[model samples]
Target: MLRHVVLFTWSDDADEERREQTLAALRRLPEEVGGMTSFAVGPDAGLREGNAHTALVADFPDVEAWRRYADDPVHLQIIADHVKPILAARSAVQYEV
Candidate 1:
């Protein structure tokens, strides 16, 4: 299996409503993309002061499957429409499990 992880820090002006809208868009991915074995997303619990504001973890059967999800139009649309505007910084990692 392949695991895809993402951490996001929102823009200074990002508000609760925008964050929730982004989360709602993220929640729709499993149904819209193929080859996702598992997926999860949540806000940071504030246990650590400098942690990213939000995070996402997704499991795929293989790198190709991960690629499909990465390139999916629906996913791109959501990122562009809902996420990009509010994003300050983002990082990701993909590894074999």
Candidate 2:
């Protein structure tokens, strides 16, 4: 399987309502798109200083599945409409699991 992890830092203007909207949209990805075996996303736990504001973890069966998820229109829309506007920085990795 392939595990995809993404960390996001939001802009200072990202308020509670916008953050919640982004989270709500992201939480719908598995249902709205295909090839995601499992998915989880949420704000950081505040356990450490300088952590990313949010994290997303998803599992897929293979590279092709991951690619489909990456290219899915719903996912793209969510990024465009919800994430990009508030995003300041992002880091991501995909690895075998």
lDDT of 2 by residue, 1-97 (tens): 9999999999999999999999999998988986888899999999999999999999999999999999988899999999999999999999999
Worst 10 residues of 2 by lDDT: 29-38
On TM-score, the leading prediction is 2
lDDT of 1 by residue, 1-97 (tens): 9999999999989989989999988988998775788999989899988899999999999998999889999899999998899999999999988
| Residue 13 displacement (Å), model 2 | 0.7
lDDT of each: 0.92, 0.94
Worst 10 residues of 1 by lDDT: 27-36
Q: Candidate 2: global Cα-lDDT?
A: 0.94
